[model samples]
Target: MKTLVNTLMMRVIEYFASKDMSQITHTLCVHEYTRLIALREGYKTRKVLLLELAALLHDIGCPRSKELYGNCLPVNQERIGAEIVSEWMPAYGKLAPKEIDWLVKVVGTHHQLPMAKEYGFEALFEADLIVNLMEGYYPKEKAALYEKNMVRTASGKALFELFFHHGKMDIKSD
Candidate 1:
C-alpha cells in the first residue's frame, strides 16, 4: 500500500513537474509535516492518508495554470487543480467515490478558503503554512497573523509554536 501510495504521488506530480526543485521539495516537506501533525493529533489512518495525499497534490495545478495563463495565480491554480485532481483520484485506486470527491474539494479550495476546520483540510493548511513560513514565501507578520486568527487544530497550533514561535527542533515528539 505504501509503495502504491508513493507511486501515485509521483504520478500526480508528473502532471507538471517544475524544473526548479523547490516546488517538489516543498510539497514533500508539506506531506511529511501533514503526516506528522495528523499522527500527533491522533487522526485515524485513512484521514492521515487523505491529508498526506492532499499535501502532495495541493500544488498540482500550478504548472497547468502556468501553461494556460502564463502565470500560476492561486485562484486559477485552485480552480484548475480541482479539475485535475478529480480526474486523477480514480487512478490512485481503492478510493471510494465520496473520498475522491472529498479529496478533490480539499485540493481545489485549499488556497481559496479562509478555513475549512476539517481534519484533513486543517492539516494540509497548517503543513503548507509551515513550509511557506520557513521558505519566506509568506512574511512573518502575515504568517503570525494567520497563526493567531486562522490556525484551528491543536497539533497545527503546537507546530506553529514550535517552528515559528519557539524556534525549536523538537517537532517529532511534540
Candidate 2:
C-alpha cells in the first residue's frame, strides 16, 4: 500500500509540477494540513492516506477549468475535477473501484460545505479551506464563520483557530 501510495504521489506531483508550480504548492499545503488533521483526529492509516490523496487532487481540474472557462471558479473546478479524477485515477493510480468513486464524489463536492460530512470529506474540506485562507482566497475576517459553520473535527477547529485567529479564538469543540 505504501509503495502504491508513493507511486501515485509521485505521479500527482509530476502532473502538477508540469502544469503549474503554484497549484502544486497549494496542493502540497492542503495535503500537509489534511495529514495533520487526520492524524490528530485519530484516524487509521488507510483513511488518512485516502484523505491525503483527495487533498492532493482536490484542485486537479483548475487547469482544465482555466482552459474551458478562462476562470477556475469553484463550481467549474469541482465539475471538471471530478471528471478528471474519475478518468485519471483508475488508469494511473490503480485505486479500488469504490475508492475511485469516493474520490470522484469528494473532488466533485469539495466546495459544497454540506456534502463534506455526508461524503466523509470533512478533513479534505477543512484542509482545503485552511490553505485557501492562508492563500488569501478567503477573507481573514470570515474565519470564525467558517469555524462555526463548516468545521466539524476538533483537530480542524483547533488548527483553524491556531492559524487564522492566532490560537485565540474560543471555538467550542465539536
Candidate 3:
C-alpha cells in the first residue's frame, strides 16, 4: 500500500511539475503538513495514506481550472478536481471504490471550510490553509481569520501560530 501510494504521489508530482513547478512545491508542502497533523492526531495508517493522497491531488484541477475558467477559484478547482480524481483513480488500480469516493469528496470539498470536516478532511483543509498562508495567498487579516476559524487540530494550530502568528496570539482550541 505504501509503495503504491508513493508511486501515485510521484505521478501526481510529475503532473504538477510539468504544469508548474510552484504547484509541485505547494503540493509537497500541503502533503507534509497533512502527514504531520494526521500522525499527531493519531490517524491509523490507512487514514494517513488517504489524507496524503488527497493532499497531493487537492489542487489537481488548477491547470484545467486555469484553462477553462481563466482562474483557479476554489469552486472551479473543487469541481474539476473531483472529476479528475474520479476519472483518473480507477485506472491506477490503487484505491478501492470507497477510498476513491472519499478522495473525491476530500478533493472536491477541501475549500468548503467546516463542511469539509464532515468528509474527514479537516487535516487536509488545515494543511492547505497553512501552505496558502505561507505562500501569501491570503491577506494578513484574512489569514488570521482563517486560522481562528479553520485550524482545528493541535498540530495544525501550532504550525499556524509558529509560521503565521509567531507565537504571539494565545489561540484556544474548540
Candidate 4:
C-alpha cells in the first residue's frame, strides 16, 4: 500500500514535471511530516495514507492558479486541484466520491483554518505549517505558537515541537 502510494505520488510529480519542482518537494515533505505525526497518534494506516495523498496533491492546482491569476489562494487552489484530482477518479480506482470530496477540501484549504472537525485535515494542515515555519515563510513567533497549539494528535505535536526548535530552514534576511 505504501509503495503504491509513493508510486502514485511520483506519477503526480511527473505529470506536473513542467511546474515548479520546489512545490513538489514542499508537498512531499508536508505529507511525510504529517504521516509521522499521524502515526504516533494511532491513526489507522488507511487514514494516514489518505492524508499523505491529500498532502501531496493539495497544491496540484497551483500552476493553473498561477497562470490564471498569479496566486495560489486557498479557495482558488483547492477548487482547481480538486477538479483536477476528481478527473483522475476513474484511474485512481475504488475511491468513493466522498473520499474525493474530502481530498479536494483538504487540498483547497490547507492555507486557511481547518474547517472540518475530522483530525485528518487538521493533521495535514498542521504538517504543512510545520514545513512553512521551517521555510521562514510564516512569522516566527506566531508560527512557533501555531506549531505549539494547533496539532491535534500526539505525534503531530511532537513533530511540530521538533521543527519549531530545530528545523533546518531559516528565514532569509530581507
Question: What TM-score against the true fold does each predicted structure earn?
Answer: 0.87, 0.91, 0.91, 0.84
Model 3: per-residue lDDT, tens digit, 1-174? 788678878988888878767788899999998988888888899999999889989999998899899999999999999999999889988789999999998898898886667888788899998888778897765777888788888888888778877785344443
Kindly report which residue pairs in candidate 2 clash with one another: none
Model 1 per-residue lDDT at 100: 85
The candidates, ranked best first by TM-score, are 3, 2, 1, 4
Please give, for residues 63-171, the per-residue lDDT of candidate 4 as tens digits.
8888888997767787888788777644767567787777777766667665634435777777787788778878777855785567565555666555566544322
True-vs-predicted CA distance for residue 60, candidate 2, Å: 0.4
lDDT of 1 at 126: 82
lDDT of 1 by residue, 74-167 (tens): 7898888889889878876778899888878888788643535652478788888888888888887676788887787778888888777876
In candidate 4, how many clashes are counted?
Answer: 1
lDDT of 2 by residue, 1-174 (tens): 666666767877888788766897898888888888888888898888888888888999998898899999999999999999888888765578999999899999999878888888788899999989889999989999988988999988988878888876444353
Give the whole-model CA lDDT for all candidates, comma-separated.
0.78, 0.86, 0.86, 0.72
Better of 2 and 4 by TM-score: 2
